[model samples]
Target: MAMAQNFRSAFHGFNREDVVRYLEYLNSKHNSAINQLKSENQTLTDELKALRAQTVSNPAAEAECARLQEENQKLLQQCGDLAGQIAKLQAQMEEAQKNKPLAEEELEAYRRAEQAERAAKERARQIYCQATGALAEATTQVDEAAEDFKLLSQRIATQMTDLQSTIDRSKEALTGAAATLYGVCSADTDSQ
Candidate 1:
């Protein structure tokens, strides 16, 4: 029998209802086939028993009896083959049933892993945003500090220019006082 391979997907895994329904369908078909084979085997066995009884009571129909026996043997062989097939099918079904839970567990593990990965990505994105904001704030503060330093340098340059002009005026005044004192001393000496 051909097995189904495709199943509908659900959020967590394959759709449970669809998988269960398919399994139930295959089981029903298998049971029916097994029952039919058993029924045919029983019918053949009954007929063979009846033929054997007839052969014992009536020895004149030996050729017909031999032919019937051959046909019965062939039928029995066919029934045995059918029984072997049924056994194999049952074994396969049992194996499938045994593995169902393991498959579900694996699918659950995959779902959990996917969720964790998404959470990690979200955390990384949040960190990136925070770092970018901090960088922008630091850049603004540095620009402000640089502007303040430039203004302070300009003010110090102006103060130095004013101090130099005061010093030049003081030097001229002292020179004029010295020249007047020398001229007064010379006049006094000549008059005496």
Candidate 2:
């Protein structure tokens, strides 16, 4: 461009009428450069607007929201089911605990009854043994009494035989005394 200015100066010294022609060529070149820059800026602006509109119209964002809502519903239902199961199990455990003491009491009652029955049976056995011992002692005393009676009967028969012999000897002595008295009486009568 400096060389073009020098050429314009030299041509101007030749004829002052060429000054308009040089100014016209420089203006045309500047105009062409400005038009190219304006067209490029307009094309970049249109691309940015198209990208903004496409982002607003997308279906992927809507599908992701629906999926999240469905997952939340499933989680809530699962939690409710678990809570119900826990409540039923707790009730069953409490019922079993309530019956435990009653069963233990019944078992203790049966044990006490058996112990009382055993004590009663032992008392009966002791009484029976005592009665049997008393009966045996009485039977032995009766047998001893029978043996003493037989010994007393034999001693009485021996005393009766000795008394009969003494009576016979006394009768002979009395007959002799009576004969002597009769002789004395006959002699006295003849003398008189």
The TM-score leader among the candidates is: 1
Top of the candidates by lDDT? 1
User: What is the TM-score (0 to 1) of candidate 1?
Assistant: 0.64
* Candidate 1 lowest-lDDT run of ten: 55-64
In model 1, state the lDDT of residue 111: 88
Q: Candidate 1, clashing residue pairs?
A: none
RMSD of 2: 44.7
lDDT of 2 by residue, 58-168 (tens): 566446544544554554455455445545545554554575566567668877988989988998888888878877887777777777777766666566666555665
Residue 35 shift from truth in candidate 2, angstroms:
72
How do all models score by TM-score? 0.64, 0.37
* Cα misplacement distance, residue 42 of candidate 1 (Å): 3.0
Candidate 1: where is the Cα deviation over 4 Å? Answer: 1-31, 55-64, 167-192
